[model samples]
Target: MIRRANPADEATIRDCAEQAYRRYVPIIGRKPAPMVVDFAAQIKAGHVHVAVDGDTFQGFIVFFPKGDHMLLENVAVLPSAAGRGIGRSLIGFCEEQARRGGFTAVRLYTNEKMVENLTLYPRLGYAEVARRTEHGFSRVYFEKIIGGPGA
Candidate 1:
């Protein structure tokens, strides 16, 4: 199941992100953005959700609606829980929520050093929109149009 994350889930959520993104720290030469995210602030804004199995938190996705699309800010899953479809489910949750909010698309950005995401996002139907160095990190941006043109 997936539901809005509350204050109680903050620790689990941060742990999950830390574990998931830890491998990339060496690759990126620093902790990735997700590692330093302020979950307390995110939760306070109601922009976080967690995927659960029974009583366990499997993963989380953070997002918010933008003018033309939902910005999928971050997504992380327990590496031990990989292949359980938690990541995709969280993304689907975000997309469905965006559709309900009348957004025509979803946008997301990731570090270019994360090769897995480059292939994964395209396989999931998100097309590359741009790539640039931002905040000293080489970032790749992607977007998926979920609604008709000119919505």
Candidate 2:
């Protein structure tokens, strides 16, 4: 199940993000952007949602509205829970949110060094929209229109 994360889940959410993104540190020559987020603030602002399996935390997705689209800020699955579709489910949740909120699309960006996302986003229907250096991180931006034609 996926539910809005509260202050209490901040620690576990941070841990999951650390474990999921730590390997990318060396590839980027520094910590990924998600690593330094203030989870407590995000939760308090009602932006984080967690994926749970009964009593265990599996993953989490952070998203927010940006004009006509939903910005998918971050998503991470615990290393031990990889390949169980938790990450995908979390993303599905984000997409559902966009649909319900009357948003036209879902947008996200990942580090250029994160090759997995470079391929995965396209397979999931997102198209590359931009690329640039921001806050010292080279990012690849993608957007998936919520509905129309093949959508």
Query: In model 1, where is the ten-residue run with the lowest total lDDT?
Result: 142-151
Candidate 2's TM-score: 0.96
- Tell me which residue pairs clash in candidate 1: none
Question: In model 1, what is the error at residue 69, expressed in angstroms?
Answer: 0.9
Clashes per candidate (backbone, < 3 Å): 0, 0
| Model 2 weakest 10-residue run by lDDT | 142-151
Error of 2 at 118 (Å): 0.5
Off by over 4 Å in 2: 148-151
Candidate 1's TM-score: 0.96
On residues 1-151, what C-alpha lDDT tens digit does candidate 1 reach at each position? 9999999999999999999999999999999999998999999999999999999889999999888789999999999899988899999888888888888899999999999999999999899999999888999999998884334
